[model samples]
Target: MRPLPPEALPVIVAARRTAIGTAGHAFKEVTADRLAAPVIQVVARDVACLGVPIDDVVLGNCMGPGGNLARVSALGAGLGEAVPGATVDRQCGSGLAAILMAGQAVASEEMELVIAGGAESASTAPLRAHRESPDTPYERAPFTPAGHPDPDMGAAAEALAAARGVERERQDDYAGASNAKAVAAREAGRFAAEIVEVGGRTEDQRPRLMRPASLSRLPAAFVPGGSVTAGNSSPVSDGAAVVALTSERLRAGAGLPGLRLRGGAVVGCDPALPGWGPVPAVRRLLGRTGVSMEQIAAVEIVEAFAAQTLAVTDALGLDPLGADRERVCADGGALALGHPWGATGAVVVTRLFTRLVRSGAPPGTLGLATAAVGGGLGVAALFEVV
Candidate 1:
C-alpha cells in the first residue's frame, strides 16, 4: 500500500472520558446521552484553540435507546445544530469502530475535524424483546442468526478457556494483578488528567485490591463447573469516551502533540468463540502496517474476561506474567475498571493517548488498542505518537 499524503492523515489531538461507574450505581439515573455529552464537551473544549468547526460527531453504542445517540450527544454538548451525528453498532467493538470510521473520513479529506467515540449506560438500557414475543423479554439481541452457533459471552469465554487449556488459577491470578495495577495507578493519580467529572464523581467505581483467596472462593457464573466467574470478568458499567480527530495539516498548524492513525483492521471468527477475535485482528493490523510487536511501546486490550485476555495474549506470544506485561495495560483494563460495552473500546484508546501522548513518549512511539466483540469479531487499530 502507498503512503497517505500528509494532508490526508488523521490525527487525534485530544481525548477524554467520564469516570466509569458500575451499573445501577452512581450513574443509574443518567441516560447514555447524558453520560456522553460531558465527555464530548470537554474534548471539544480541549481542542477549541484550533478554531475549526466540528464537521460531524460519530459514536458507537450497543444497548442504548434506539435513536441516533451520536447526534443526541452532540446536541447535548451544545455543538450547535449544524454539527451532524452518526451512530455505529458492532457490539463490544463499537467504540473503536467509531474512531476508525472518523479516521477514515478525515483521511478522505472531506472533513477538517470530527468528534468520535462511544458511550454506554448499561444501567438504563431498555428491556429488549422480539416483535413476535413482545410479552417476554430477552437479555440481548442475538449476535448471529439461527443457523450459526452463538453462545452468550460468558458461555463463550468458558468454552474458549476449556478449548485453550486456560485454568482457573491463571485467570484468577491475572485478574488480581490487573486489579492491583489499577488501584496503584489510581492512587498515583495517573488517571486524573484524562478523567472528566460527571455528577461529581471523579473516580472509577470498580478498581480495588483483589486477594487470591477471595477470588478462589467465587463460584462459576456461566456454565456449571466452569472456570469463568464474575471475579475474573468485567462488571457491567456506565461510561463514555470521546476524542477529537483532525487532518494532519490542522495538527501541524496548531503545534499540538497527537496520535496519528496508522492502520486499523476488523475481522470475524467463529461465533462460538468470540473472545479469540482479537488475535487475528491484531495480526492483520500489524501485517498491514508492517509494524512488529517489538516496536509497540504500549498496548491496551479490553479485558472483558481474564480467560479471554489470557488466551489472546498467549496466542499473540505476549507475556502476561513477565516484565513484558507492563507494556500491556500498564494502568489496568476493563477487568478492573468495569466494562461499559460500547465505551470500553474508546476507553482503551483514551488510555493509550494518556500513556503515549500525555506521558510524553517521543514522536513515532507506537501503541495499539484492540477489543474482542461479543459475536466473534475483533477490532484493532495502531497509533503512533506525533
Candidate 2:
C-alpha cells in the first residue's frame, strides 16, 4: 500500500551511515540495543547542522531481545524525551521501511526532520526465543505470527534464483564483482564519507585466547555446498544509517537546503520469483516521475546475493557487464562491506545520498534503492536530486 497523502516536500536533506563492522569481530561486544544509539547518534546528533527539529525516530531491527527497542534506542540517541519513536521490522527491508515511513510522515506534512534508520549487531544479535520453552507461540507472538514475520531472505533468494533460471556460478561472478568494486571503493576512500569510525577492537570479536588464524581459515555460516559462502555472501555486520528529512516549510522557514524525498515505491513479486520485483518498482518510479533508467546516475540494489543482483540487473535490461554496470553500485555493495539485515536498506539509501552529493551530475540525478523481503516481497524506492 502507498504511504498516505502522497505529495509535498518531505525530502531527505542529510543522510549518514556507519562503517559496516565485521560481525562478531568488530562489533562483538556491542549489543543490538546498544549498537543502534551510537551508529544513529553519529549523525542525528547533528540535528543542529540540518537546522530543524527532529520530529521522530523510526528505527528497524531484524531481531532484538525485547519490544520497544525503537523507543529505547531513540532515547539513547539523545532525543528530548518529547520526540516519539517507533520500531519497524521488514526483515532485510526493515531499514528501507524506516526511511519510507519518515518520508511518508514528512510528505504528509505531519512532521519535519524525521530521523529514520536501522541497526543490527548480528554478532551480538540474539534470536527471540526461550530456550527453556522453545515451542511456545506465546513469546514468539510479537515478532513472528503477528508483527514482522516473513520467509527468510536467503531461502527466498535461492528460490528466486532457481525460478528465474539464475546459474550458481554466474551468481558467484556477481559476488566477485561486488567484492572487487567494494575493495576498490574502500581503497579510493569512496566510502570514507559514509562509514564512521567507531572506537573499538575489530568490528567483530574473536575469543581472547583463540588468537591468530591462517589466511584461508574462517568459519562458515549457513550451507556448505553453495556459492553463497561467508566470503561470497554479506558479512554478519554491525552498523546503522540515518536520514534526517525536513519538509519544504521547514527548509524555507529554517533556511536549509532540504533535498526532497520525491516519491519512493515498493513492488512485490511471487515468493518463488521474489527477485523480479525491482524491475516493476523501478519502472513505476520512473514512469511516475517521467524519468528513464538511462537517466539514473547511480542505483543501489541490495546484494542479498550476487545472483539476486545479477538477476535484477538483467531484468532491468541493463547490461550486466560492460559500462552500464559501472554506473550502478559505484560505492560498492553489501557483499564487499557487510549486510546487517534491517540496516541494509538504509545503508543503501545512505550510500545513494552520498553518491548524489558527490556525483558530478546536476541536481535530479535519479537514484534507486531496492531490497528483497521475506515471503515473496520486494521493495524499490527511487529518488532524483532536485
Please provide TM-scores, in order, for all candidate models, with all chains considered together. 0.98, 0.84
Give one digit per residue, the lDDT tens place, for model 1 in 1-386.
13575456799999999999999998999999999999999999999988999999999999999889999999999999999999999999999999999999988888889999999999999998888999889878889999999899999999999999999999999999999999999999999999999999999998999999999999999999999999999999999999999988889999999999998999999899999999999999998888899899899999999999999999988887676679989998999998999889999999999999999999989999999998799999999999
Residues 1-386 of candidate 2 have per-residue lDDT tens digits of: 24333236476766777667777666677776566676567667555765666778898887666576777887887877888888888777889888888888877678867888888777775555466877753322232344433445555566556666776656655566666666666667677666655655222211111111221233323435433444445656777777777766665565544345656667665655565667777777777766677877778988877667777888787764567667777656887777888788998998887777644456656778888765555777777675
Candidate 2: TM-score?
A: 0.84
- Report the number of the highest-TM-score candidate: 1
Which stretches in model 1 have alpha-carbon errors above 4 Å? Answer: 1-7
lDDT measured at residue 274 in model 1 versus the true structure, 0 to 100: 99
**Candidate 1 accuracy as TM-score:** 0.98
For model 2, give the 10-residue run with minimal summed lDDT: 206-215
The lDDT of model 2 is 0.68
